[model samples]
Target: MEQFPILLGAGIVLLFVFWFGFLSLKMKMPNVILYILLGIILAKWISHHEILHFASEIGIVILFFLLGLEFKLKRLGGIARKIWPAGLLDVFLNLGVVTFIGIWYGLDPFYAFLLGGVAYATSSSITAKLLGDTGRMANRESEFILGILIFEDLVAPIVVAIIIGLSTGEPMTLFDSGILVIKIFGITVAAIILGKTVFKKFDQFLNKIHDEDFKIALFIGIALSYGGLALWLGLSEVLGAFLAGMMLSDVERIERVEQTVHPIQNLVLPIFFVYFGTTIQFVNGVPMLPLLAILVFWSIAGKMLVGIIGGKLYGLSPRVSFRAGLSLCSRGEFSVIIASIATGVFKIFSGIYIVLLALIGMLLFTRAPQMTNKLFGKPVKKKKGLKVPGS
Candidate 1:
């Protein structure tokens, strides 16, 4: 048969995604893993398709942008202050320890660090979706989980930049690293200033406008442009997109704005996962099975430790902390981005690692509350008015 027209092909892909999404809802499974599996199955047909890649980028940027919409500068400051210690613990366990393991396994230091970077981040997309889908957004542990994800977002870009530099044999100097830090700081400050000044009055102006088209265009433009700016500055687009959303959080009717952008984000975001799956190439059978086993074990354990210890430090109860840890073991987009840096055996290794851990993480996340319940039992409720001998 002649090839389907591009538009028609795109429509078919969306239908498949919608079907998978529906199945996920019915089965109570996270749609993320399903979309990824779809990508892997369809990789032969769709691998490296430019349009899919671009759409995926748009989806993720908007996802982070929407996430940013939830936080204003003041609230963000509070979260940062409370979450830093746990964030530091996360860094040490996932990145620091994993890198050490890599070196011990006989890989060069650079390769080892790549391994660490792959292990360092939890899948923000997966975690966020699970939180929303599982109705865990209102759970006690959600705040801690989100805080850790945000911390990883801030750190991963710098790690990526450093990795890129090292991979190219032009490793970043201390001065260069300082410059990157400054760029991140500058962008953050600029977003804050814009939110406080320009967008502070945006609600009144938005109310004055009647065109939904213009409103969405403005929202998406800000997200993509900021994300693009981060790329230009040698940082992560997710960071820029997040800052873009935060810049608009000062607007009074932000929910209405989100209502406009959320559909578009949902539509494109599945493509991101599917595209990710397509990028996984397994030319040879899994390389270094023993090493893969070790890294996989550590990936889950490291994140669990971060969640449990960090949660305690953040003032959560032990039960809540354990649940938080269980939900964090899945590594997603950041892992994929870092893994793309590898070639040959390492690339295949990272691919398998990401897919396996993502599946396990999703399963654990779905079962976290139950798992915690088994360990701690349900929190006992006190009898009301049953009361007191004194009474």
Candidate 2:
């Protein structure tokens, strides 16, 4: 508990950062990048002391849980046909491309596979922000992108589970992956049942309290309880949080929950981003120009191909599809999580520093709307009687 002061101070600083950072966003910049930069600077000033690691981890867990809450299983079900095809193609194709590159870089087959998997996921946070920023949340193109992202988010944990099983070297096979899936399904069903039975009643009881503070405490209790259960079940904590959120999504108290949680989310989520920057070692005194160039090119091109194929399959116009692919190419927090798993848990991979550098480079280049527009051009406007791609 000696570290409590540092943790508390960090939380306060994060709140300030988020407040100012969001203000910066209104001036046409990304708060995410700003938060990351703040984290990096703080770490450098302190020489990378483990000051914010614990708080940052909590932030990530909560962020993932909130992600799950926003899952909208029903909405995803509506677009399953288009989403599944595009998502599968996106993941596999991106995997194949990255795997080949990994092999070319002299990584072994196992490491190559891990690298490919890491590269396959799109950044859900970034996608959400982009859609909101462009006012395209309701557009067809936006729907396609969102569907693909949501599908990726749902499937990512399964892939992570498979990678974890394989890394353990305990007879990972098709049967094992299947069994893992079954277990996850079982856990989901149990969570839904228990949540519906016990949590619904508890939440109702809390609703009768009529005190805002008590209601907020009840909301946190529910999120933490479900999130804890998920971790205990060997599932991602985010999955549990998501399930909890979904259960409460249609509740009358959802608006209150959102309001009470908003400040906490704003404070913690940025720490996750900043800690991401601090974790990057920037080894060998920063990557040289040649290696950086190759990584950036491949990262961009790999996603471009996935986007094009996805767009074509969805019968979108060539331009719209190309833009969609370009827009989806940027890898953010999810990629970092994959890299950490590769380096820390798997031990089968060695080029994690390089991957991290590559991802950061990609993030630096792709974290803005202007870069996206420069790459894909602005959405085409259609005549009054015609349909626009996003419209």
Candidate 3:
């Protein structure tokens, strides 16, 4: 009988998600944000019930796994040269700017650095979907954005490790951080090598078995194993999932694995976004109206500035550069992950509310047609491609 209520709640959440997701698609709003808002409403009504919490946790794991499956090592490699420099610049510049702002606001230096680091990242899934939906996935600018996002993903854990060390008041010296980084790189390389060998052999065996269910089980086993190992090593599960995906990218069974996993991924991932929205408790009982207004302006202005500067550096036209900047403004899961870490490790309670507000505001503004029109202009031209920065 206990399971009955849980099942009923799950069904309701799923129903609302599908309904809102459909609306979002038709209205050109971001479905992820809509799912999150719905989750917040449910959480408020239910007051963080245990069943909902479990479902959301599972959703996060599935989302990370699917994110891993999307990693294309070949595509990333093809644009590494251009991507690395641009991505590095983007991270450093944004980090510098945001950090300055945090410090100016009297935040501790460590907290400022954490804020800056979180701000540096761009959401890979959100950006990819937007580009894909808009038919700009094949554009050179899109490739550049993809490459930068991949690079940022790779850099995130390293920053997290540093933040962890600093928060613990355990030597976060440059030398120590550098050593940690090298160790992480070594682990990554080892994961790739080991993953390739194991996945290759597993693929061969799965092919011979020729049972779809069995093959799917085998794939999940591999992903979960790697994910577990990563957690054991104090690394993020998403990093592990990404590595696992890269390992299996060359296997003949990849398409089958993707097909089998996608529905499960879609169904569960929204829960993560929803959990994100629900956990946002206003600090000190602050009224929602004033807080919301401040966050909205900051989120939009900060990202727009970054985009304009990045675009101009690349020699893009004023409009394209402005659009790129605006498009890049949306912050998703990574920001939430960083905020959670900040609260746990640094004891930064104020930052939690700040980041949550920023995230929610970003979601509210990151709509399709609105952002599209802001960046691309009316009747987005096909012939005139994105003008490269400094060109």
Between prediction 1 and prediction 3, the one with superior TM-score is 1
Name the top lDDT candidate: 1
Q: What stretches of model 1 exceed 4 Å from their correct place?
A: 1-5, 382-391
lDDT of 3 by residue, 148-249 (tens): 566777787777777777778884788876776775676578766765676656567656776677765766666667666776776666666667666777
- Estimated TM-score per prediction? 0.95, 0.76, 0.77
TM-score, predicted candidate 3 vs. hidden true structure: 0.77
Q: Give lDDT: candidate 2, residue 50.
A: 59
Looking at model 1, report the run of 10 residues with the lowest lDDT sum.
Answer: 3-12
Q: Candidate 1: give its CA RMSD in angstroms.
A: 2.0
Candidate lDDT (C-alpha), each:
0.91, 0.63, 0.63
Question: How many Å off is the CA of 175 in candidate 1?
Answer: 1.0
lDDT of 1 by residue, 113-188 (tens): 9999999999998898889878999899988898999899989998998999999998799998999899999999
Question: Backbone clashes per model, in order?
Answer: 0, 2, 10
lDDT of 2 at 270: 67
Q: Which stretches of model 3 miss by more than 4 angstroms?
A: 1-8, 25-28, 45-72, 128-136, 201-204, 283-323, 341-391
